[model samples]
Target: MKTYETLVAEALTVVPEILPWDLQSRLEQAPAPLLLDVREPEEYAAMHIPGSLHAPRGILEAAAQWGFEETLPELVRARDSEVVVICRSGRRSALAGRTLVEMGFKQVQSLKMGVRGWNDDGGALEDADGNEVDPELADEYFRARVRPEQMGP
Candidate 1:
């Protein structure tokens, strides 16, 4: 079996990594690529990129098969759509990007540094209700939950 490092290296070769600022700029452009969050439901609920679609890494491959009541986004169901996968710290989403590439997705990328980078770069996150998450609360959560070791230099 391939090691995590091996897998991530392979994914990095094929899937381009986009910084938070780059993604923010892209979103401002017309026809923005789909932002797909591969974090768990609770993580997504706590905070996520505005306009991102949630498909937890565990169920990402089968997301299309899930019922609409489960909140499966239509963009994930479409095979040919351009997608950027994101997780808490970019590791899971790198694997998810590899999965999408293996599944024959033509255009797939992983967000560099994940939501942490986005938050650090002053990007806004939305709550479950689609309201903008308070910056202080977001910072508190990040500091409390994210270890310094987790944030790679």
Candidate 2:
């Protein structure tokens, strides 16, 4: 049986991942990739990469398509644009990137290490209001909180 880890691994195989620095460089280029943050709203409100568009994973498919109430016109139009899917630690983004690929997106990639990695790499992060988030505080937010029940049996 495939576990969550296996699913993320499988998704990475089909969805290329971009390192934080590389992604930053790409963003500086003429045509920047659309940064899609798939994390929940609360998580995003706390901190996120600047310019990232929020599209929670729960309704990602609907948000990506046209004619749905949840439809994000930017996402729908980005089907032919370079898209970078992001999440807390990269796992969710990889899964979302795979979905974008299947949804006929021309170019889809996951952010390697996600917002956590970016913060670790000295990248700037912003709150939903566009205020700069303190790196140290962001570190605290991104810290792994594995539960006992989630550990190896």
**Top TM-score model:** 2
Local distance difference test scores for all models: 0.84, 0.94
Question: Against the hidden reference, what TM-scores do the models get?
Answer: 0.83, 0.97
Model 2: weakest 10-residue lDDT segment is 24-33
Cα lDDT of model 2 by residue, 1-153, tens digit:
999999999999999999999998899997898999999999999998999889999999999999999999999999999999999989999999999999999899999999999999999999988999999999999988999998988
- Tens digits of per-residue lDDT for model 1, 21-94: 99989888877888889998999999999888888877777774445544465754556877899998788888
Question: Global lDDT for candidate 1?
Answer: 0.84
Backbone clash total, candidate 2: 0
RMSD of 1: 4.0
